[model samples]
Target: MDPVGYSHDEKGVSKEPQHVISEGDHGADTELRRLLSTRHLTMIALGSSIGMGLWLGSGESLSSGGPAGIFIGYVLAGSMIWSVSHSIGEMAVMYPLPSAFVQWTGKFVDPSAAFALGWAYWFSYCITIANELQGIVTVLSFWTDKVPVAAWITIFLVVIVLINVCAVSVFGEVEVIASSIKFGWIFVVIISMIVISAGGAPNHEAVGFRYWNSSPFTHGFKGFLNVLPTCIFAMSGSENSGLVAAETANPRKSVPRAIGSIWLRLSLFYLLGSLMVTINVSPYNPDIFGGSGTNASPFVIAYREAGLQPLAHIMNAVIFISVLSTGSISGYGGSRTTMGLAHLGMAPRQFARADKTGRPWLGLLVTLVLGGGLAYLNVNNSASNVFTWFSNLTSLFTLFGWGMICFSHIRMRYTWKLQGRDVAELPWKSWTYPYAAWWGLIWCMVLMVVEFYLAVWPLGKPSSAKTFFANYVSVIAILVLYFGARLYYRGPWWVDASTIDLDAHRRFYADKDPEAKKTGFKAKTSKTLGFIFN
Candidate 1:
């Protein structure tokens, strides 16, 4: 057998990869079903990324980084994400394999790297689940403190788990509906911001560029760098589009289309949203710093400050929904990643178990039990504090995951050249070859160093051992996983690019028709809406 677990016959035809699960438990349909349509892929890409990181945590970003700091930070982060999307899209279109990055790292890089990255990446999603749950507790407090935080956490936890453990079609439909609601709410918020900036509020005060003018940058260059972590948090899940390729009906078409649209989503939703927040809300507002619920949201703060009290309430409710949408996405991402780890034999075989409906129920249960359970930390610590802890950890892990993606892409490209393969043979090619990959990898390292600086001296706070270790624990965890896997597996630190089995699990052999089948008005409508829902 090859190092990646697939063997080839004398004729060079690839055999099926070895399975970790036993035959008795491997009932019919062991793989996730390709039931998700292009619509589902597009919406998941858009919705999974629009979460508490923007709605509530942006307030903390503004408080620490100020208006210009965050706006610039997001711009840089957006570019880095663009590179990552393209790099992953190229590979996903060709492989269309389960556990997208995990498999890629194992095949193209090294098995040890795959084992380490797989677990860390899964834990990142888990942390995101916990972060969103904590956001829900904070958002709900806007309406009533009479209800216990634990009650709301439990209610939403059950709801998300159910959504994830069902057939993926159910999960896809739910995401489309939830994503639509989030899109509408964000549109309303952006338009409201524009109107309010132009003195449309009852107070008739044009706050045009007032916040930016007062203090565009906070805490200087360090403050701008500090904002990068929150930017990573906000844009963390765009790569999940590639992760779902194996579950998509037509990954060659849908995955590239979805990945290609990431730039537009980042530009419209995240970039514009952050810009509006900066223009409408003052960074120095006491309420924007360390409060709970909608009171801490810059959007809600801007509305209330403009005397638009009712709008503030409506915004908070929408934010509550946004939290649920993201929490559900986190669950989906976590379960799938855990299942991928199991398939790679990096985890227990039971984690790979799926029901007849093709739901990874056991993995979903584990994610809910471990990841969802972290939400209860709000019972002891303040919701904002817990949010900060998870966000910091998640953001660091995201950087590492993205960096590895770029590194893997670089290694794959080198191997492709050594194998005498033509770039034209690829189903989808990255927009800019080695440059995009290098750009992403370089920025990831730069930001990792920035995180270290902030860990030592947090924004607007004195340096403390507690703060430093808390911020770096995520980094330490990944290093531990990587070295531990190396010690156990006793494999080469890095696989030789020349020896990589590039053809393993590759979905395409001889090229077929590049054009997709168009049916009727529905297909035409889908094609017409390709700009958004491709």
Candidate 2:
């Protein structure tokens, strides 16, 4: 390694840091300042997590599991996500980087895990971005059905790409704007739903929790379990906030606060949002779902029930912003993940190149353009099939990433004890370890098993068709391609710690704030207060 610590590009590419092609070679890629604040991080986390899913799919989940069932499902999954967020928060503070999980998986687990998780996550976000851009055309169809989805999709692709390509702060600003619109729509819908349900409307009497109590299907443990995946998916933005960890000035502070915001997102946004949807309209009605149109969102349906004209138009606008913010973040995520993979020798090295704004320009644009193409192609036919494939596969890889995070924490905890370290030294400790991680794994495993069964038999009935794969033949195809590449490359299943880079990290991330020049402010403050009291 050179004295400055940056490894030279193998192909003798640009000597510039931004153009560095390899990782495990410590270096800086851009002159971009770390500018994101706690507030930005928090909103970014919420914005990325709150997707079109809540607006689009909650009705189906509610239908499967009644009001109580839906609530229980979200509460349960949100609780687990909270635990995972904290676990991630604790580690993130110690090692903030754009390749957040990639570093951890490589350093703590193995290079292979990092590579696999990074690529899988990258693909997932790519799919999500594609889906989001595709949605814009569908939403705009409310105004003029004559316009082609492809044309609008191309237009939006350019707009979002320009915003992202400008600068990190610019991207952050645009995301916040989009997020505000999303939040505003959800809040208004929720409040309006409450007003309508409380004997405020002529046809509707005070429902007063009647919708939660009544459902076509039996509501109980069975129902709650059924809606669990949807709930988890709604709160799915757990990994995004940390995507900026490396780019922020004080990730140590911003990331934890962003992590804290998960609770707020779940409690205030998701919970209230679901409650509003359930109360305004009953989930059991066939009118709510199983519809002829792509406008199957529960929020829009409730707004219609409350006598809102141009119901599709209103919700469509809200969803448009939601899709934009989410897809932008997803593109960011895919680029960073690619950079991480390139660093780990899992992918070719050009992806590590960054622009003057510290953004992975080529990487982000590639994912965006590719995702846009896939989404626009689906304009001829409904893209539900593509959406489903991306969602399930992405969730699968995410579950794997979660497992690695928990396991890495477990090892860190042990290493600390062995080195005579104290738990108090950590900036944040996981709410409950081993237990939380184990139970999460168990829960995910159960869900995976059920999904497999549902995929094979479908709704509990046996199917003998060899072609039937729950219509997930596409996912299988991707998996085969991925594993087949692994076989072809003879990729190592395990990584050696010695082969990994373990340099002293930036102080902000490792929680050894150089500016403070003091350790344990909380501890010091407590001791001084105790002395005074004594």
Candidate 3:
């Protein structure tokens, strides 16, 4: 019997527990659906990543890093993400599945990794949903200061619950529409700002680098690092992607096609977007963000400051859409993570249950309850700071997950080489390996260290001490829950490799005639779409 990737239910009881794929709970009526298209997956990656981070939080990065500093961060982070995307792309082509990451973590590494990494990664999604809930409430305040944040939180939770309960294709369609709105709004914002800054307006005579000269980033290196908390926070949803693997139509093509260009997409979204914004808007007054007055989308700020008409309200509505898009995505991501954890046995069995539509109904419910409860915190006076506390604490965990991805790729590379595999034949290869992986690991480590110091330093920085301690506490708590549970059950380290079927995954790749028989509802719809498209 294998330790985890393919083991029995009774706590690894048998010496040779059947090594066959457990007629997985979710894919019962079908040979696990292959539903996503490259176009759908690519849009998903773009949509999931290019949101609230840019529309809502780019200002923070601009103010902190300046145009140059922010670009540096995005380019660096984007490069590392590129390596990750390629690594994922290669494996995704080889064996695409719904819970591909979870399966891969278990198969290539160990069950303990699958349990720990999956759960921790899932927890990040959960925490982010709470954070986004807070954002929605904050944005809604623009229209109505009278309604309590808690009420808005409930409203958004209901929206997410309804969406989650819908059929999977409905979920996919919502994603498509939501992504369209976000990308559309961001493009509009960037273009409008660039034009406003270039032409002379009524009162402000063509503000050209005025803000940059006025600010000139006098804060130095440490200050640059200091404001990076949100910069990191902005890019949080990239990993939110693996959640959709179970639903992707053709895992091999779709996952790679979707996950492959992370670097380029994020660069344009984060790097190019920030440059336009910083050059257009005031750098970082902290006064413009939310305190008083119109609190314009900084793009609107740049425009109106240049004597443009009241564009702030328009941008506000756009931001509302962006938040809704991101919040919905956040919920979907959290629910999938919960489902993955349950299916993998790290969570309660009930949480793994899905409705007839393959919706993880219980998982979605739990995420709602948790996310809703967190939103209730918005009514508290300290809600804003608490939001910061949670937001600041998350990047380290993201760094860890990415680092594991790099490690997993290294392991996969070793395994591939061990079997005398040819690099040229691989679908996608991570560049300058040993080099790229090492550099990425170093970058991830540096971010962690800087973040750790930011959390603990007590250098008279207010949020650092508590944030550091709390972040560590959450990580430790996650570790304890995963390893402690594993030890209590006394699970073995490795499973019979043969039991972990890569054949089903390979079949999807091998079959030239993709128009095969219907597997289930998801497959039928996907097949219909493929027939139409192909």
Candidate 4:
């Protein structure tokens, strides 16, 4: 087989001139189309992060850690997410592909790490798919309790599956619209919060830092540390932009922009929103801990407390839309991760198959079955317990994924130096470099340790050993997969820096290639916005 030419398909037929499957060449011939635009990419990243977690789950964080604690936790977590995004963005733009960082782990570090991270990430998304589906039921119950939870879950599962099985363009467009709605709604809510805080509501009572001073820390520093898991879960999907890089148009330009905007989005929607919640809704408010469902959302509680019952209902509806958008994006992420795994020969070849529209039907179908089953299981459990279980399962996997991205970036830069590759040749680079990557890696490890401690010895609460294992099971499972891959594959513990393939499968365009030139106001505007945002 030619290293840079056509390779045999599963049928042993040389169908097309595809780059050989090697370091950077994994999934080079994937049928997934590059139909997503800059807007789609940006919205997907933004929409994925601003979901039910922000709307409803923040209540849990606020309840666990008081206003000051929650704010501090998000600031710390936001910085770590930013570092991870930069590290992943630099590599995704350089070699844009599905599950870019996962493949990079294999190329720059070790196949075992890639295998572990890929499966860990896939599992995380699948769990999120179920969590979001269950979330729909919880959100709907806010308006009425007439519908059975099982029916709601089934309906949502079908709708999400349909979206994932459609053309990639349809998914991109849906995400664009959904994400835009979420972005606009957040600003509206933030402004409303500001009004409420400043005595603009019917009650006309100013709530300036009252909650912060009265209950700055719940259960002291331990309570503040306890909320870290919820905060981490809220920020989990911010990196989905990199997963879409393979299917994004002008990814070298678009991906970096999408990744760069993460901090801004996090600050506006998460950090500032937390401030708004703390100001408008007291930590001691019973509604802040309204068990499960959308009723517990700080946005809803704050509005209702301000004597605006109608606005609370409206916010509850918006939470439903937010969760639906999240479910759709989770489906997309899970299917793509599955396809990436299959592309690397870790999963069955059929799992990598796609239809005419470049939709990964087989992988999507498999994910739907698993995710739907989990959602169905939740139908029998209390919504609060279901949310807690899923959240616990998902919390650690993201930290592990971020750790891998930072580690991989460190190794990639080392290899680039060893190969004498010019940094100027890179499309995007992380300004923070060694420090940013190291900071992300070390803190992620610290958070994981803290998470384990909270699981066993929760502050001001009691938990059993069984509960502890359940919470940390994903971590244990990934460890098993990592060592299992290492033993089975018996590849080098780490690839040599000089032997790393940095150039293969790069999406290069000639000066005369039709896409190389920009025309029209829309194109130029898009480019400018991407540059500014990224």
Per lDDT, the best of the predicted structures is 1
Across 398-476, the per-residue lDDT of candidate 1 in tens digits comes to 9988998898899888999999999888877876888989999999998999899989988778899999988888899
Clashes of each: 0, 0, 12, 1
Best by TM-score: 1
Which pairs clash (backbone N, Cα, C closer than 3 Å) in model 4? 257-534
Candidate 3: which stretches are off by over 4 Å?
1-5, 8-33, 202-204, 214-218, 260-264, 290-296, 382-384, 422-435, 458-467, 482-486, 489-508, 512-534
**What do the candidate models score in CA lDDT, each in turn?**
0.80, 0.63, 0.62, 0.79
lDDT of 4 by residue, 176-281 (tens): 8888787888788889889888999999989888888899887788989877887888888987888888887666667767876787788888899888998888
The window of 10 residues in a row where model 2 has the poorest summed lDDT is 14-23
lDDT of 2 by residue, 1-534 (tens): 111223445753212122321222222233334666665776787778677556655766677677877777777777667767776777776666567777666656644455566776777677677767765665565467787777888888887778777778888778777776776676677667777789675456677678765563445555555465556556666677666766666656577667766777787677888888777767765654323454456676665666665654677677777877777787778887777666555666677777655777667877887777777665776644444444555555565666667666665566666666688877566667767766665665566665555456543246655424533443464466456555643435553333333333423233354434545887678545532221
Sorting all predicted structures by TM-score, with the top scorer first, yields: 1, 4, 3, 2
RMSD of each: 4.0, 6.7, 5.7, 4.6
The parts of candidate 4 lying over 4 Å away from their true place are: 1-27, 289-295, 509-534
Candidate 2: global Cα-lDDT? 0.63
Ranking by lDDT: 1, 4, 2, 3
Per-residue C-alpha lDDT of model 3 across residues 1-534, encoded as one tens digit per residue: 233233354654333222222222233122233344556566677777655556656555565556556656666767776666666666655544445566566656666777777777666666777777777776666567898777788888788777767777776778777776766666776677667676645664566677667764635666566556566667767765555655665555466557655755675677777777767766555534433344435655665566655666676676776667666776777676666566555677676666666777776777767766766766774444555555665665677677776766667777666666677766555455777766667777788778766666522357654456765555675577567657754556654443443333332334443434556787889865753342
> What TM-score does each of the candidates earn?
0.92, 0.81, 0.83, 0.91
